[model samples]
Target chain A: MKSAVKIMFLSALFAMCCFSGNARAYEYQGVDIRGFISQGYLQSTDNNFFAETEDGTSQFNEAGINFSAEVSDRLRLGVQFLSRDLGTIGNNEVILDWAIADYHFRDWLGLTVGNMKFVHGLYNETRDLDMVRTFILMPQSVYIEAWREAISSIQGAGLYGDLGLSDMGSLSYDLQYGTVNLDSDKGAARLLGDQWPFEGMGLLVDVDQINVDYTYAGSIRWITNLEGLILGGSTWGYQFEADATTLLDTTNPMAAAMLQNNPGFVDLVGPLNAYGARFMLSPSEFGVETVSYTASMEFMWRNLVFAAEYMRTTYNIEFRNSPLFTTLEPVLSANGVAVQDGTIEVDQFSSVGYYASLAYRFAPWFELGTYYSVYYPNEDDKDGKERVAKGLDDQDHRGWLKDIALTTRFDVNENWIVKLEAHKMDGSAILLGADNPAPEDPAEDRYEEDWYLFAAKMTFHF
Target chain B: MKLRSIPLIARIVLAGIVLSAFGGFIVPAGHAASEVMVVAHGSVPVESLSRDAVQEIFLGRKTRWSDGQKITLATLKEGEEHEAFLRMYVGKTPHQFKNYWKSQVFTGRGKAPEAFTSPDELAEFVTNTPGAIGYLPQRAYQNQLKSFMIE
Candidate 1:
């Protein structure tokens, strides 16, 4: 309740700030406000096979109201207030989308400060817009939930600019320092209370409080054009993060074992390093006699992008090591294993993925495009960490996961656009927990089959 | 051989008709595919621009002109011939172009060009404003509005 009041007060203050100020009439110094809202109906053949309900269909679906105001030529402020239902679950939240102040010193140098998105690829910064992106599902590797948590946006400052390689090419660079948020924190006290069903007897109210801490990241992008072909390459650098799940109390040994086996659980706290590249070949100027194609391919190398990212989370806890190993085997006793205090530390995790999309303009106002991508995780941990954390079996490669999606858009007119898309996702990581066991099955491989989706959107901007 | 001679007036008329036909065949005027002049302040140093480069600058890809001047692409009112000009030269309708800038504007990715209602106003704005670049009709070229060649 107190938090709600604080949020309201802050919102009011922001509104006043937006409305107040010295009115400037310079050519490049004015405020530009824009927004869009979308509402539609959705029906699902099987709300995904993992869904507990039979046939799933929804009506009166709607998108949150999103708007951005260019406070000045150099600064932008925006937010997304939304209430939407994903399958059966619904959420109402206000996300601070972006607040940035940009300064262009020269054509070759610029700097920005505030909460900003990662410069992972061509679409990473602008992927939120349905109008700009070709696919509804972003390449899953870099944008997967786990990766989103690991490397998406941080509250910090960044430096970005271009270096002229020649008239035809330039190298783009970005460096950022920011803070990451902690999701939740659970302790052994909760587990013991759940197991014994006892209360008032040393019941530790270990509230899972969200934590905000320091984070720094950087990126380098090199783009050049050759014979009408634009080629871009980028590399991402980041600090790691770990999940919030940990056993703080020392009483329960079972909790410690569970934590040891699940050290790789996505820790909301950790350091990360990721990178990727994009190559776009546009044939509009190639003098192609027939249909022209604008083909773009992007590749991302990053850590795991799923709930299992917990195991790879960078925390000070040694959840990966415990007395269970020596207990299981006498020969393992020679390993000199140490009992972990229930924390996980991750040095780094990386994956390689790419999206290949081909768009052909059938007319001046219309175009058709198709794209697909495969994301694979690096299975470096032989301790079955990837399998248990990702819910895959030992047969799973630390780097073996793939997802593909196909999309088509029709520009009905200047003010309206309609898009139809279907996604064929394969892998244990894509599962959003529907038939999967509860969080209790930390090591369970909840691999889902080729789930399909049919969705559409309409947008109007003024 | 048949008549031994022809009337002088008739012969003269025949000769005039033949000469006129020859002249018509020999002299052909070039089609009026006139070049557009991008007018700017004398401070801007540029003589010519490629069609693609012009399109990119006007379309907001290339932010600066060759002379290191920040290129500010402006436009007249909707449905004006300027829309057709942009379409012909930049391969984008004026509405499409504005919306592109609008997206960039609200996103804080780029700056939106100032708009006017008439070529005269645009010319006046461009000529007076530093680092401003605008297009004017060749016929409207005067001492007040200078024109740069855009091939």
Candidate 2:
């Protein structure tokens, strides 16, 4: 709580210092410079939301600076450096957010080579700019925080253009093909391990490295003639391989048969009834292929803006070179004990998410916004019965998450902004296990079905 | 205890809001809506342009003109006339206009148009650069620049 107060005081002090500033025109000659920084606080009533929100963490912040220049009439060069921290994710790591050399041969055809931002939904490209967005946290349903780095940008070549449709309207399209860097210790890898129920059987997997073969993203937006309406669709695909290590306990099903038939396994039996012995498994690899698509619409009239989007992502996974076959099978077979020799199987499934949001600038200093968001980890198993049958979760609420959020944004000045938001959430689909560990009791639930989260943020930009 | 300090912060912020309201502190922009005229460089443009065509140019949709000349856009830094141009011609508020260009820049898609501090500087820029377009107060006078009527 004291940390939260300290952050609030810092933000207020920063806002006061920049209150009298004018609109920034950071250009000299032909180069333009722009940058922004923001700090935020979060507190949740029940489950932790990414950070240690239950204790009210002040560990959310982002900073970025960009430089751009028009080399000639047909060419432009631009780059931005960004650093962000959210709980254990970014850890204040400075990364080359985006750098591109863009050449427009014509309005209908342009080429960009370098690291370019990916367009998923309508707002993914602008998600990092706190001063531009209305919410302190965008809807988690469609924009899962865990996958931000995976889809934030692509490194390779992109083709973009705006085609005039005359009376019909105009169409803007972008196509990019490249690969993204993923950190095994980050949220994406942890989220992947949650897909299978290995931990319940005393088997745990730790990912050490992740590599992407290729990623392709494409988007098209139709700016209709109807004054203030836009329709857009975007899709991206990724193929990843992860090297992992596993730990298996004495009572592991694959080892159960070996222990029962052999009397020489009495050394393992004593501990099997006690704290249990753990064996390390040889390294294995996970092959994952994912495809995600989003359909979006946005409308603006006067000071009011409304947007809605539906997103679905499907993953096909195969784990090969399992410890069950490589490590324990040899030991058991040499002792005339037979063990299961196969890989763990996880069926292909798609996750579904959708949200509708509205924001209105009520006054020069005040804006109000609200959104309703929903997410299902498995589109076909919304009730979670299949998960319970498979020992994945103890409660049905784990299958889906529904959230309603309200935000009030205060524009303290032209260069500074402060915002507060509240969320009412039901269910727990994406809460990670690292922050919320399960109880020792097998029947006990790990997460609460209802919770509340509060957020406050302050941003300064020039 | 967890909830006690939050209201304190809220109260402090509320007091700040009330103080700002009565302190005579001026907001950066409450730009008055007005009739803003579109001016283009004399070297390359027609006398009149459709409203749709004007919106396309400012939004960076149409980068080239009918005569195949590259379109260079100029904008005022911030003022009543600047807000007027965005609202009347670009079909967006000043806030929306700023966010739009910022999105393009940060995403490495495109660069924002050149912005000038005063109408005379903007007029000078438009006059000197070929295929340039800008906006000014309806009565603002300029040299060697063609005025386009928004049909």
- Please tell me which predicted candidate would have the highest DockQ against the true structure: 2
Give the whole-model CA lDDT for all candidates, comma-separated: 0.44, 0.80
Tens digits of per-residue lDDT, candidate 1, B1-151, equal: 0111323423433343344335434653223344345677666777776665665667565666565666666776544456556655665544346545654654446656677778778887887877777776666575566566666
Fnat by candidate, in order: 0.04, 0.38
**In candidate 2, what are the lDDT values of residues A1-462, reduced to their tens digit?**
645644554454345346525646366577776777889998887787888888888899987777788898888898887778888888766778899899999998999999999879899998999888789988988899888888888899999999989888899999999999999867888787776465655556778899999999999999999888999999999999998866556555645555465455433222222224766655567889999999999999878899999999998987665435444455535634344444544678999999999997766677778899999999999988888777677778889999998887888987889988888899998888766877767576678888877888999887
Distance from true location, Cα of B63 in model 1, Å = 5.3
TM-score of chain B of each: 0.68, 0.80
Give the per-residue lDDT digits (tens) of candidate 2, residues B27-143: 443556777789999877588998888999999988887788988899998788988788777888877888888777767777788889899899989989999999987775733
TM-score of chain A of each: 0.60, 0.87
Q: Which stretches of candidate 1 lie over 4 Å from their true place?
A: A1-29, A39-90, A149-152, A182-213, A237-349, A379-401, A434-447, B1-35, B41-71, B75-103, B115-128, B136-144
A257, model 2: CA deviation in Å?
A: 8.5
TM-score of chain B of 1: 0.68
The Cα error of candidate 2 at residue A339, in Å, is 12
Model 2 interface Cα RMSD in Å: 4.1
